[model samples]
Target: MATPSSPFSFLDDLFNRIGERLQPPAWAVHEIQHRAVLFLNHVLQQEPEAQQRLLRQQGRVVRFQWRFVTMEMVATPAGLLDLAPAGSVPELTLTVTDESPFELARATLRGGKPSVQIIGDVQLAAEVNWLVDHVRWDVEDDLARLVGDVPAHTIANGARRVVDALRQFVGGRKPPQAGGPSTGSASTAE
Candidate 1:
């Protein structure tokens, strides 16, 4: 991790420190799942500067907007951890490049996240799509404002806490009743 000397690199250093200090915990998967959904929700609320949303069936909405973005950690070819953020797309129909997307993810998960490119890999992309296809995002807030909220911070902290818990878990230390994502009890309403 780079030193937190510049404003640009401060968050990177913070994440690196967090990753080391917060090893995977028993609740890692659940927290990631929760955060992934929230991130997608946050993204959905962001519209293209000119708006790229549709009013659909039963007054529902469908948007391919690229407003809300978040990060994902993946294993690398060198066996390291890195983080990737989601990219922007004002339109719903994307080119879906196999290598560019997956390679970006692999790089980030491997701890070589590019300073210039902050986007997630397929695993993270799939998670985002799951939320977009199945859940609804709040369309009122921008990404910065949404992420700045108390509730959003709480959710992020929940994710980070659970991930920290998982490192110990994979090592055979289990926390009682950390629970799974299928119990249908989510920290936020979708």
Candidate 2:
């Protein structure tokens, strides 16, 4: 007798094929990375300290990888970033440890940091961490320029509330302290 295919197995196979077909071309990937670099540089330009940090790392190549996508960027003396030349060795590499895009997006929307592994230069990693902790995109300001200030503020507030709700729904509870008593109901009397 032939083995039967499960519905979930069939669905998974279909989705995999669809994803393969929808993947962007190399040039599109390059364009997207270029835009991302531009956006990062714009945000960095707003902070003099961030620019100074980048300036200290000028000529250093940092490679960032998340899943199958990778982008290598070089810090310029002008304290901006540019795409590192192909075949250049990176001085530092940062890899996002989370494999699930949904989980990563949820954490980001919840204002939680995504876990990452750093390899190579320690000073560079520290600088990058400081930048991550301090720098934030001014989405509301950008939106206000496009739309009216009132609408932009309203939209931003709504988005924040939605993200808060999602975070709560995603089990945002903190874990019990190390070596401390359990916080679960089972640990409580009655």
Candidate 3:
């Protein structure tokens, strides 16, 4: 017989099946870390490239990457991490730490964007707007919580603005674009 479908029905059945069996939330201080490798898979669908990047197994490790975007997770005592290419090691790196993926994605744009601190000085609060212009995370909800102490709003707005600017830049460039260091594609660590 075909089962009757309702929006809440699946949830009700799920609760009935596992609510009593599930354990309470764990208080483990996970030091999550992982490597985000970049380079288009050529396939519209991408898959994991290595064992070091698996985030859910244990400890404090979480890595994600796609296209030219990449990140490396180094677990901390608290908060979360949003992965993105900031600069380079010899360069710099940008990260967003917040309560959830949604918060990070939203703050990845706008003026008061997260502080892109290079060394103790160089700060790029507006850098997130740059990421958005290049289609960094695909959508707002697709981001991951890399564990850190980051306010949500800044990341959200910064990402939004970056995407807007990137669209304009690409549309105007239309390939065959020649330039210098200031005009080259962003470099990411895999």
lDDT tens digits by residue: candidate 3, 1-190: 8684544556556654564476444332121212222122111122232121222221333333322233444322222233323332322344443323323334543223443333221322122233334323333233333323253445766876667775555345443335634655688899
Residue-pair clashes, model 2: 0
lDDT at position 123, candidate 1: 43
lDDT of each: 0.40, 0.85, 0.35
- Candidate of highest TM-score: 2
lDDT of 2 by residue, 1-190 (tens): 6553543455555655776678889899999999999999999888899999999999999999986679999999999899999998998999999765665766776778889999999999999899999988888988999998999999999997776677677756554456798566664566
TM-score, every prediction: 0.21, 0.77, 0.20
RMSD of 1: 20.5
lDDT of 1 by residue, 82-170 (tens): 23333422222223232233344444444343323224344434433544354444432333365666666667667666655654443
Runs in model 3 deviating more than 4 A are: 1-88, 105-131, 135-190
State the displacement of the C-alpha of residue 22, model 1, in Å, after optimal TM-score superposition: 1.3
